[model samples]
Target: MGVDAARGLSVIGMTMVHVGPNSAEGLGGAIYGFPHGRASVLFVLVAGIGAALLSRTDERRWDARLRLFWIAALFLLIGLGLQSLDHGVAVILQHYTAFYLLALLLIPASPSLLFGLGIATALVGPIAYFVLRRLLSDVVERETVGWGDGLGDVLAGLVLTGPYPVLVWGAIVIWGMWIGRQKLTYASVQWILIASGIVVAISAEAISWLALGQYGRPDDSTDWRNLLIADGHSQMPLWLISSIGSATALVGIGLAIGRRWPSAIWPLAALGQVALTYYIAHLVALHFLEDRLRFSDVRHAAPSAMMLAVLGIGFAIAWRRYLRRGPVEWIMARPFDRHRRREASQNPRP
Candidate 1:
């Protein structure tokens, strides 16, 4: 439930980043700036935690793969459909599908092993990204979103680049599994999550500052090599580290929200419960009803964001009162084996 709340918050953060003009100025800018990469990372990391939890259940092993594949297909297919809408948003469900496919082999591993591998990936993967992208410059530049873009580009986008590159993003999932293995309900564990998160995030940014200097900009010589320390430049080692820290912080804070403020948490948690439904609908709304919703412009997006937040909160609370799952979720699970679809065997509303 707490994780659900966390996911809801993460999606809300994404809403701000997507709608706003990437502000770097005032209160609106602050909202847009802080959650840009941070929220997306948290979303993926929470997904990892959710997957780990599902794998720990007694359900048939094949059932998990079947369910994941089905979900992945749905996300990819729908994401392509959303792309046709041309709402100017870079949809992430395509990358998420790739992540799920990757997780099939990973869901069974021990938490310690996952955490260790996550650390290793963080250390090595970004350097690999820089080297690989430059080596495969032409292939890397090809469009991976639309069909007929060629298989090489699609694979690269999934494994090496994009809105969320799976190689580095996979590490977040791995660490999330480690987090899932812990007794998150325990206050001590929660605080430890907060503590370790801060250490890693700060370390990444500090290293970046030391290497690049406060005002140093990305140059031809430094851009590729400096990935070792560059923050805000997605897929870099430093950025990955800091994002992991922020993701963990969100998990800790989410649990705290669940434990302390049940009343306030209810609406957000409800929204979390229907996340896929809301997420997809958000894009649809932004596409067809952008003007009606009055968030068509990035410069004036905060108001629309606020409005959608309130509406989603209220709608989720109301909808969940009557149905256990959102429409999209229920549809996704309908084809699964009956036993696997049981509430006990399912992943939470990710």
Candidate 2:
């Protein structure tokens, strides 16, 4: 159930990210900003919570860890394959897999240790990056390589090109795991997270404004530095802090709102349940639309709205009727089947 919620948030975020601007001026634009980024963070945090939950289920911790390692490898391979087709190296699932592999070793530690690690990563990772960038900016620019060159370069780029977000993201996961272990219900956590979220959200935004700057009203061909340094779009440092703060608030709000009217968000949740499917599907669909259908000339607003509506409706319908796991998720779950079967068979020993 928690996994479903996380997946739902991911799908919604991916859709908005891919679609860019939409027709509706107010709601759609806001979704594209802090909300979209926050959704991605929530997805990662919940992933940590799910991982911790899974670790507690059985005694074969080594086998479980191996399974996760392979799954991460698979995601990395998929990302490589997609990049080969010139799809760009922003494949987040690959990053998730990589983080999960790293987190597996840390999963067994005490909550305080995990939390401490989270705080350390969140604080220290960016400082290290800034220092490295100051020293290596010229060299890094001189190399000037894309991620698709090879596995080693891709791995290296993954580490060097923006490891801070992943570090903070991993921290969120650890934090979620710590939260998940508690004996609170969804409702109770919602209120607590909401109140805390607001405080964090304000702090994050303030830090973002101080570190970066505010958006200078939307326009075509906005300056790259402005975008990079702007409140919602900045990277590392301010980006990590602000996004985390906003994400905390949003998750709290989502849970609170979800409790009040579950049905209102049933569609969003449904879309989330089949997130991997929807994510890959969106990429493929966009490729076809732009490359084959020749919609490359179309404006961002109309096409984005159309695609968002189509994806939302399609996923909601699929979730309402389907009983099986999403195709990609099912493929990812294959490593667990052997253990599940062994457990099942052991339960009724002959």
Candidate 3:
């Protein structure tokens, strides 16, 4: 329920970032902009946690791992098909698939190793990404992920230049795996996570402010100094630190809320459980509504975002009363279910 609650928040956050007053001035901007980048970060982190939980089995691990790879392939195909629609949104499913694949390597690692790798990546990955961008400046042809985009462009976007670079963003997923391994049912763990998150977030922000204050924020985006700013989507080390901290805090809060008042978060839990279905559904909605609405303008976008969120929550709640799995989720699980049944048939209990 806690994981679902956090996932629900991430889903809502994505909606706000996609269709709300993200760049509007004053309170609206502050409200809407809060989810920018962080929502996706949280979403990916939740995925990692889910992966960890999925692989927690005493049976042969290969089957579970194989299932994950299959799902990744599924995501890649669906993401590509969605991108072909040329919807105004940058589809993240492809990048999400990439994360799933990378996580396979660390799924069996110890919690300490996972934590160490996550921290190391958080510190070093951004620098390497920036360096590679400079090195590949003239090599890889930059293009957005969309239909008709060259294969090379799509691959590059998934790994490096896209809005969510796996190199740096992968750290969040690794940290999430670490968190997932912990005894989350304990109040001590939850409070510790909350404290750690608060400390990391504040420290990163404070350092960023001091560094940018002394060196000054650069107007030229190419300036190395820009890396000191911890704005969302900046893809800088500081931003990664801050976002990871924020994601950790969110998960902790969700867990606390869920354990304390499951009833209060029931609607969100329902929405979260069917997040994948809603994610694609909302994009489909946007595709159709694009002609009627100007999502670029916050005035129209904000209300539309709220309306979609309300509808999604209501639909999810209503759907849960009758169905356990969502439409898309059920489809995704079919192959695995069949595989398990086949194994059971072939190797019946002795």
Candidate 4:
């Protein structure tokens, strides 16, 4: 339930970042900056936890991991297809697919191992990328996100140049899996998450303040790479800490909500169950706006985003009320279901 709630929150955050205004003057500015890279971080973090949970269940059967690989491939394909829509948004799902594949390799690791690796990656990934970018012969810097770009360029976008680089972003997922192994339903665990999040977020900002003030580091200059790392440049150590801590805090809040307002959480829970459905639906809505309504300006896109998101959740609740799973989820799982059934028949449990 907490997982679902966190997922729902990420979806909403991502939508706002995509469709809301872009300025630093008023409410729009606040809303625009809220999700920046954090929403995608949370989304993938939840995915890591989900993968861990799935692996646990798969302990009873052998084919689950194989199915996971197929699912990852499908997501990669779907994400690339969404990019073909050319919605002017840097979608995370493309990189998300690659992270899933990378995460799968570590899914069976113990919780301690997951946490250790996550921390190591968060600390070292940026430096490694910094060096590798130079060593990769500036290949990543020249690349741009587009359907026409070469496959090599696209791979670089997923790995190094994109806003959500898999190397750093995937560490959040690993940490999330570690958290998922914890006693999430406990109030003590929730408090730790909340406290850690607030502390780390504040610390990151304080560091940035010092960098820009006492040290006289210009925020615009890329020379001091860590200056604006908190919420903008996600490849930095502080940015990963701030964002993953935010995600941890969100999951904790979800747990609290599940305990306190069981009824109120149902709608978002429903939306979370069908997160992929709504994810794809939003891009389709954007495509429709492009093709039919001819809405060219993002300044006024908030209403459309709100309408589509509301409609998507509303339909999800209505559909889930009668059906077991969302349409796309059902479609994705059917093949695995059939295989499981056939395997069960072939080796009858005596």
Per TM-score, the best of the predicted structures is: 3
- Report how far residue 287 has shifted in candidate 1, in Å: 1.5
Clashing residue pairs in all predictions, respectively, total: 0, 2, 0, 0
- Model 1: per-residue Cα lDDT over 40-149, one tens digit each: 78888888887777677656556777777888788778776776775677778878788788777787778778878988988787777777677776554424374554
Clashing pairs in 3: none
TM-score of 3: 0.93
Poorly placed runs, candidate 2 (over 4 Å): 21-31, 57-63, 86-89, 138-148, 162-168, 184-186, 210-233, 257-261, 291-306, 309-313, 316-320
* lDDT-best of 1 and 2: 1
Summarize candidate 2's per-residue lDDT along 292-325 as a digit string, tens digits: 3222222554366456656655766576576555
Query: What's the ranking of the predictions by lDDT, best on top?
Result: 3, 1, 4, 2
- lDDT of each candidate versus the true structure: 0.76, 0.58, 0.82, 0.73
RMSD of 3: 2.1
**Alpha carbon lDDT at 78, candidate 2:** 69
Model 3 clash count equals: 0
TM-score of each: 0.89, 0.78, 0.93, 0.88
What's the distance in Å from true for residue 231, model 1? Answer: 4.2
Total clashes in model 2, counting residue pairs 3 or more apart in sequence or in different chains: 2
